[model samples]
Target: MIGYVTIGVSDMARAKAFYSDLLADLDARVLMDLDRIAFFGQSMGKPMLAVCTPYDKQPNHPGNGNMVAINPGSKELVDKLYHKAIELGATCDGEPGQRIPDRFYGAYIRDLDGNKVAFFHFG
Candidate 1:
């Protein structure tokens, strides 16, 4: 298994803003702010996501089609992440609600790098 997912972004400030709001489900307990990276983790586990400051790529270009789906644990956490992402200027993909297609009762929000990160409850 890997240690963390370092997602590249153009601006650390913008990445911090989006992720700060996105990861607010766990509050500052999980997201530890640093110089160029926004580190996020689950309680009692290793660092889960690292929104890294971009180097050479365009502002919103994501190099991967893969997305990091966050297991929010409940409907409330899913709602929190969805709303917060929009509140922090993230573009909404799948709104804060349920989806019958993928069995994903979740929301999808694209971050600064245009990476679709899903917040799911799976129930």
Candidate 2:
């Protein structure tokens, strides 16, 4: 099982700010803060999401098909989080909409460091 997910970032400060604002809507706050990484989540039991500089001391790169999916609690919250990510400079990968009528709704975006993130809700 996945305990947490980490995304590499070139600029720690920028990534921190981007996630700080974006995750606020989900009630995810800083759980751990270190010079090279920061973790965010609503609780320790929930999977944490982190941003960090590469441990290899090389330039950070996003994985081509990897992504972190976040549940924002409701269809409306999915829309809000997706838009908020855009407002914080994240690029849109998909607009908020139903993936399956009355079953799944979601949206996707690339974070400041170009890592894919999704916001979704199930009915």
Give the per-residue lDDT of model 2 (tens digit) for 9-105: 9998999888988888778888889989999898888899989999989999999999999987899999999999999999999999999999999
Top model by TM-score, which number?
2
Pairs with steric clashes in candidate 1:
none
Candidate 1 residue-wise lDDT, 9-110, digit = tens: 778777776665666667434446677666777643664788776655545466567788888788888888788888777789888776876566888888
lDDT of 2 at 8: 97
Per-model TM-score, in order, reads: 0.76, 0.95
In candidate 2, position 121 carries an lDDT of 95
Which residue pairs show collisions in model 2? none
Which regions of candidate 1 deviate over 4 angstroms?
28-34, 42-44, 55-60, 101-103
Worst 10 residues of 2 by lDDT: 21-30
Candidate models: Cα lDDT each: 0.73, 0.92
TM-score of 2: 0.95
